[model samples]
Target: MSARLEVRLDDERKQRLEQLGEAEGVPISEVVRRLIDDAWEEVMRARRIAAVERMAQLEVEDPPDPETLSRELEETYGPGGLS
Candidate 1:
């Protein structure tokens, strides 16, 4: 139930796609389709992860103490913490 997709590529990109398809033992169209599918899966996975994180953040109960929270923030944003 997939529709046909017509794309215009520069000669160099076309050659590269052909070479990649040959190396992978698949048709160029299949290579493109797989790449697109993989990208879509990655995007969906990221969205799911973000949604879960947002839900967890929303589930927090009482507010953290300011001093403890500041320390935690300093620790998190300090030398050996998440960027």
Candidate 2:
């Protein structure tokens, strides 16, 4: 099943949609559908980005200190430290 949306655009925007539809030889509804699809995709992409940023923040909240890691690396390898 599919849902429906009803939007009201200003005169200039409506005219632009109409012009684009005519130029592409498609109906205004198709233009609206494509625009809505693009908008929804952008919204979801932004949400995903926010989620990833939050996860990274949580993961790095108490990350390993740099000096300790360097010491461990030096112990594993000799003075050159794997070049």
Candidate 3:
């Protein structure tokens, strides 16, 4: 389902949107939709970045030993020895 949206833009912004639409071979509405999609993607990307940053700041207690992790990896992926 699609709903209609009415936005009031200044003359300068309107001209810019028109030029962008012309350059992209699309209508002004298409340009607005693309802009909205781009904005939404940026918001989602920011959320992911924030989540990663939060996780990075966390201190994990009792972390597993590197040697144990290596042994487990080798067990799961098999030895690198030539058969």
> lDDT winner among the candidates?
3
Model 3, which residues run further than 4 Å from truth?
Answer: 65-83
For each candidate, the alpha-carbon lDDT, in order, equals 0.90, 0.89, 0.91
Residue range with the least summed lDDT across 10 consecutive positions in model 1: 74-83
> What is the descending TM-score order?
3, 1, 2
Give the residue spans of candidate 1 off by over 4 A.
60-83
Q: TM-score of every model? A: 0.65, 0.59, 0.73
Report the lDDT tens digits of candidate 2 across residue range 1-83. 76887889999999999999999999998998898899999999999999999988784556569987788778999676789
Candidate 1 structure quality by residue, lDDT tens digits, 1-83: 87998999999999998998999999999989988999999999999999999998885678689878778878879854465
Q: Write the per-residue lDDT of candidate 3 for residues 9-54, one digit (tens) a residue.
A: 9999999999999999999999999999999999999999999999
TM-score winner: 3
TM-score of 2: 0.59
RMSD of 2: 7.5
* Candidate 3 global TM-score: 0.73
- Which has the better TM-score: candidate 2, or candidate 3? 3
